[model samples]
Target: MNAIPVDDDSLTWGVPSRRVAAFFIDSFLIMIVTLGFAFVFAFIHLMSFGLLRGPAHLVLLVGLIYLAGWMASPAMATPGQMAVGLSVRRADDLGRATLVQAIAFTGLLYLTLVAGVIWLGVALVTTRRRAIHDMLSGLVIVRAGALEPRPW
Candidate 1:
């Protein structure tokens, strides 16, 4: 993806609060989806007489992949992030993030959340309002529509 020139003014405005709200919204949505998957997996396991072991164990991994997939898509935002007017981009050039970066971001984000949620405090001190995962993955959270559309 070509790097897009983004103004800090457009990228950082009111993002922190929007991020918090997006987190809650995403978490709720994830929970609902996970529950649905669990039920399906349970049914499969029963039908197989417990021989298949089903896919219950992969739920968490699948959730992470789903989040990463969204981050790397043309939309560059999870459903919740899109709903809340936020997008994720490469920190260095404001380009679309690769799948690897998105996966790293998703993994690190869960780790940060698991680690007492204190890591998020770093965003308060950072100039760009970026969280630990955002910095580690070389990604940034910006306001939706902050990036110009690709000409292609």
Candidate 2:
């Protein structure tokens, strides 16, 4: 994807609090959609095989689901994000980076979910209020169509 040129007037980072609110809504929506999609796929696979798959297969499948969402969602220039006035783009305008980079970031995100939650804390403190995954993925979530930012 070509980089959306960041002009001097563009927000680039410091997006307002409302954008953060919209991000949460988008995230919840993605969760619902992805899970629904995964379940349907899993059911079909299960029925065809007439046996339950191992946890490993399920984990791989789920990872693929997320990766596909991550890749395809942004394929539209913007995704559910743009619909709600947000965009996900690389920090350095390096295309979409790579799948391995995205997966590694996701791994760190899940690992942080284990006990200490340090990465979660990092997300809370981000300049644009990006989640750990977003930061790691080098994607900024910003208001899509608005000119001026909402009041702080």
Candidate with maximal lDDT: 1
lDDT of 2 by residue, 1-152 (tens): 43335442354344545444644665676677667767876886788694555532454445444643564454522244455555445556524535565555556655666756555556457565666676666665454553343455
What are the TM-scores, per candidate, against the unseen true structure? 0.89, 0.50
- Model 2 earns a TM-score of 0.50
Q: Look at candidate 1 and tell me the lDDT of residue 92.
A: 87
Clashing pairs in 1: none
Candidate 1 residues 1-152, lDDT tens each? Answer: 74556546657778988999988888888899888888899999999999977467988776697789999999899998999999998998888999999999999999998997888988878878888999899999998765656577
